[model samples]
Target: MATSTLSRWFHGNVGMVTSVIAAIAIIAIFQIINPFFLSPQGRVTLVYAMSYFLIVACGLTFVIMIGSFDFSVVSMLKLGAIICALYIDDLGLMVIPLALLACTAMGFINGLLFAKFKVPSFLATLGMSMVIEGIALYLSRGFLHIISNRAFRSIAVTFIAGLPSIFYWALAIWGVCIFIALATPFGRQIYAIGGNPTAASLCGINVVKKRIYVFMLSGFLSGLAGILYMAQFGGGSIEMGADMSIPLFASVIAGGTSLAGGTGGPQRTILGVILITWTQAGMSMNAIGHDIQLVVFALIAIGMSILTANRKTMSIVK
Candidate 1:
């Protein structure tokens, strides 16, 4: 009975337990290696790295839990920021909403294609990603568009308690995501679909509609991250939001969310974001090469995917 109880407890709490342990381990290792890791400046930089990361991961957590994928996250981010940078002078604050609307629309299409038309989620989002990137490039003409809007920049850079406003924004959104995942009926349906779509449908859940909403949520969050990125950096360009696929996906998986789906939450992704971002921060402090960092991220992503996957749900290749 004791063995069974322990097994049950571990199975239920594995994600939280592992995430906390991993987060602590990363902090300790980094602090020891870099004496300045806990310095005020380092802390600020770490917060900046993790904050937007958490923002992007919020939507992804829901998507993963709902058994879908959105590869267009970074692209949407770039596009949204580009839209903002191009028109912030003309549209002022209105451009922010405009940019978000554009991203949300893209997400809606992603949902319609996959949920309504049976496009593979991966292929659907990947193609959408290319389309969004092309739009962003055409709009910006591959030029870096810098914004001089103090008010807009202040949205992300305003320091509170030694951290930027973006930190609080990310934290608040994460809390909302947790509530949505654990409290709302919609959130429960997401898990239901992720766990077993056919069973969920038989139980009266509208799987198709919910899947589309999930994609839309992912798009909104990704776009929000892009807006914040623009504000924080005072600019938008092709240079920003490039090659972040590994870090973003790896952060979600590293937080103990199963790649096979139905088993992770934003609550866990926060820790995962901190772990991956801080590790990147630490490695950058140590003068690690970008190529090496990519390798490290890829390995971590692959390893975590193996560890957290629900093998029973995966089909045999043969």
Candidate 2:
């Protein structure tokens, strides 16, 4: 029995082990190629970049957990950043909550269409994403806004105990997500609804309500990501979050989350994001072009997809 339990724990945590191994291997390769690759400044930049990807991945994790995809995450981030920037001067500290609320509303709308109206989550989110992109373009007119407020600036620029402020926020959010997934009744409901909505409904879970809640939470986190993105950029544009949806989704998949439904958590998604982000950072520092980075990421993602696909088969064979 003890051996069996140990095996279960190992299987469940294989993704984490993979991420650590990847991280260490990448560090070694980079160090060999460029002695300064693992320097203090480089490590700081790594954590800085990881903070944004981590927050975005956290939001994506919630959506993936519910067996739904939101293609509009990048758009949502842009919208949230623009909204927060617009209000930071007038609303001061309130800008943060207001932006998050707007993000939640957008997410709720997406969820309502999917959960209540029976619209497919992907299609609905895609349409909403287009709408958000259009609106964001209109609001900014393709220009970057330089927010000069000290309060807003501090969120992204300030640090404590040598850690980036954004890292703290991401860590806090991650803790909340961990608590939800591991301890909360609502979190279990998300897993149940994702794994089998029909079964969940029969078991007295309000599937629609649960989905809406998850979507709302997803949106709020996306918005929070935007705010953090803005802090890092010292301002933002309509293009702030462009091209993130695919990578974020790929990272979630790479982290060992099954797309067919509920079998993963934020831990997997965050680990995947860290690996991808580090890969990108290391490659970019090495002068690898964006095109090459995309290609490499695609190949890696494909390999991980195959692994994810074979998980059930591997289990059965064992």
Candidate topping lDDT: 1
Expressed as tens digits, the lDDT of each residue in 195-305 for candidate 1 is 888899999999999999999999999999999999998986887977798998999988877767788888788878987888899999999988898898898788778
What CA RMSD would you report for each candidate? 1.7, 3.5
How does candidate 2 fare on TM-score? 0.92
CA lDDT, candidate 1, residue 31:
90
lDDT, each prediction: 0.88, 0.79
Query: What stretches of model 1 exceed 4 Å from their correct place?
Result: 1-3, 315-318
Write down the TM-score of every candidate.
0.96, 0.92
Candidate 2 lDDT tens digits, 1-318: 999999988776665566667767877888798777778778778888788778777777877777787887888889889987777888887888988888889999999988898888889999999888898888788987888887787887797787678888888888888899879998898888767778999999998898888888888888999998887788877767665666787777777776655767886777787778878888889899988878777776776666555344222110
